[model samples]
Target: MTHHILKATKENVHLGGFSHLLEPALTIDSGDTIDVETYTGYYVYDKAPPEFLTPEFVDICQNLPPERKIAAGPHLLTGPIYVKDAEPGDVLEVILEAIAPSLPVGFNAIRTGWGALPQQFPQPALRFVRLDLVHNIAEFPPDSGIKIPLKPFFGILGVATPETARTSIPPGCYGGNIDNRELQTGSRVFLPIFVSGGLFSIGDGHSAQGDGEVNVTAIETSMNGRIILKLRKDLQLSTPVAETSTDIITMGFAQTLDAALEMAVKNMIDFLERFVNLSAEDAYVLCSLAVNFRITQVVNSPQKGVHGMLPKSIFSHKINL
Candidate 1:
């Protein structure tokens, strides 16, 4: 079947979270999927400065308005593309098809307060890298001058919060600002439907990033992507879950390592319970027996969120393609 296409330009609406700009409310049928094509969070900054080897340039670029900025906004969600029969207690499965970069946007390296390794290198700085998508490599022209492998991820994706408006910069259960790098293509992301039609949006696409994206930036770029959304009408999930062909991924967040782990465990427990329709006890046992948790980050302050996963084989079923 042909997928419905929606293209967002610099004009039209708030570029906050990607889900805010969904199309006219349309009810989604069970098993039906919507494929969305997106622009780089940079939205319209067609070219990036090739010599972003200092924090000064990054500061200048980041301060520009959305239209003039070189990187994408904090949020770039698409639509409240309404799912017809969706309701609370249902789960929305976002099958990530691809999240490759549309261009080699620049990377920003901050000084003191921004990096996980800030103290180790007590100087403030910024640098830009050109990405080679085909080779999955990044070129840093600075002193180190070494190329690095690229891992692309969507830094944010979520429905509107059930509570008051939250800043798009922080990662929370509502799926905002979660910089989990494994949320790459071919991964299945599961989020609970908090409101009607599961109003969803996604943007803040990154060309490449490290865990925690600690430097407060990545190879931020915008690109088109296709996501298949499945409506799980009978289940409720507290946090998000991702399944790859080889792994079952869980996410955790907290103010501390312990809290992040707790969040991760709760998230996994929620996944097991709702995905398999198991009771609480059974789900916990399933997590212990078949799940392996992976730490996604430990540097997000105020609270840190973690991500864990188990191989799909451990669950006896391959991740549905």
Candidate 2:
């Protein structure tokens, strides 16, 4: 496999959305590995301390053209990298190899009218935390003696949608803004491709976040990621699915939490039947006995997420599914 490096620059990024019309920043074959640099908070760059900002981040915020910014969302996403031979009906398997902080600071915010409990937090609040790379911890309120361990991951990993432009704020079948904390190093996100070349993009780095992301944001920061992209034509999926070392994750998003959970459970059952060769009845039974459906996120408005995690250890024999 070949290794490529993609830098986050004004020319290589699409602000706020994904569209099939955007040109590819880079093209690579299946099984290629990319070391990508991604930054976040372009809209809030002025609020950040100058010392904490990276040069590339500053350049994008200060130099990006106004037309590049999409009013629907505020994320600064990098690339629409074209995968050679990837086409509609195929699945793009994004393998997370490694993720590290590209900057020494990150911010978490609770904006008015945003977040799970927006009514409770009527006023806007932003807190910047220092990332201690040496210690691999986020130092919150330097004097408070509170340090949260850093578990960095890119919050967005999406392919171009069929729409003219799709907002980056919500996670959908295409996999955008999926704030799942479990998607750290070693996780594999499988996205169903729509347009040709599987124009994939990545952004919205988070140093750490709890499940649900209740306050609307995490330790939002710039991150460097090492990812391996492969074309998975053998798998057919109607929505995004993921896998880690210990469990298989089936995700679903909807307008309500209950609906989202139902979708997730249904997707898990579908996966069990198709991949594990279980009957529909057996899969339904297994879901109740073994699957743990967790709330992935609720802050992404109108698109709450739920993920069903089935532990691989439940099966005694090796499972390729």
Best by lDDT: 2
On residues 212-311, what C-alpha lDDT tens digit does candidate 1 reach at each position? 6666667765556777777886655677767776777777777776878877878777766656567889878877787766556554455576777766
The TM-score values for the models, in the order shown, are: 0.75, 0.97
Off by over 4 Å in 1: 11-13, 17-35, 39-47, 50-73, 109-112, 117-125, 141-145, 269-291, 299-301, 315-321
Candidate 2's error at 141, in angstroms?
A: 4.1
The local distance difference test score of each candidate is 0.62, 0.89
Sum up the clashes in candidate 1.
Answer: 30
Error of 1 at 44 (Å): 11
lDDT of 2 by residue, 9-75 (tens): 9888889899888878899999999999888888788888875577777888899876566537878
Assess the local accuracy of residue 18 in candidate 2 as a C-alpha lDDT between 0 and 100.
Answer: 91
lDDT of 1 at 267: 70
Candidate 1 similarity to native, TM-score: 0.75
**Cand. 1 Cα-lDDT:** 0.62
